[model samples]
Target: MKTNVKTSPILHLTYAAVCLALCMVLPFLTGQIPQVGSALCPMHIPVLLAGFLCGPWWALAVGAVAPLLRFALFGMPPLFPTGAAMCFELAAYGLVSGILYRKLPKKVLNVYVALIAAMLAGRVIWGIVMVVLMGLNGSAFTWAAFMAGAFVNAVPGIIVHIILIPIIVLALRKAGLAD
Candidate 1:
């Protein structure tokens, strides 16, 4: 039997707030080991989750603001380039993920598809932003650098997201919260 499932703006706002909170806190937990910090990508999890819990617009808002807000609060990530570029990258992640998930059929495979597509799109946006930022700074962003930043170095985070997101989404659905 199909029953109506409705989520209000208040709920979405609540979810986005929780996600933003996590974005602030998760990095502290993961940043202890500098070697694994980038690989683990603790800041990304909540934005991605917001994409699913809220819609693209809310997710985009969260993504675009999270880095800048964090920088404001903690002064890490350095506002000039890193945080600016991340504004676009994380927004793309949340926007693309939410859009794809809503448009595609709700299946386990589709979850993976949306997640992978979002990751790729976000990386691509990050590269483009980096290129522009680097150009403005009178530097070159080479293909090798792009490759290393986008794919090669991100392998660990990619693997973790692939394994984790679907499980969480599926579990939420099972509990009827994600209906």
Candidate 2:
């Protein structure tokens, strides 16, 4: 027999809340190690997971709020460029990932494809936001800087995401928590 379970509003809200908490805590936990936090990108993981699990709008809400919340609570990311850029970047990640996951066939390969696409889209959005914000501040953001920060500096996080997200999602599927 096939069972169709529609996600309830309470469940969606709970999941989004949990993922938002994770997004906030992960970065703070990782930030203890100085540059390692930036390299590992702990904040991105939860947003990505939320995108896969909670759908696009929930994911977008988490992504858009995480950075600003963190800045307000901890004052770590500052309120200006970094936090602002991250807001757009993570919203792109959540939006693209959730949409693609829902649209694509249910397969491990499709998840990976969706994830990579989300990563690229998020980075592009980040670059654009950075350029505009920096330009307004009389600073320049070049392609090389974007490449270095988005790709080079984030290699470890990318690798972690590529390896880990699929594992988690597949496990959730096997356990019947993911559809």
Q: For residues 56-138, what per-residue lDDT tens digits would candidate 2 score against the true structure?
A: 99999999999999889889688789999999999999999999999999988999999999999999999999999999999
RMSD of 1: 2.4
Model 1 scores what on Cα lDDT?
Answer: 0.87
1-179 per-residue lDDT for model 1 (tens digits): 64345467777888899989999998898788778776777777888888887878899999999999999999977887888998899999899988988899988898889888998999999999999999999999999999998889888888888888889888987897774
Model 2: lDDT of residue 174: 88
Which pairs of residues clash in candidate 2, taking residues 3 or more apart in a chain or in different chains?
none
RMSD of each: 2.4, 2.2
Highest lDDT model number = 2
Model 1: pairs clashing at backbone N, Cα or C within 3 Å: none
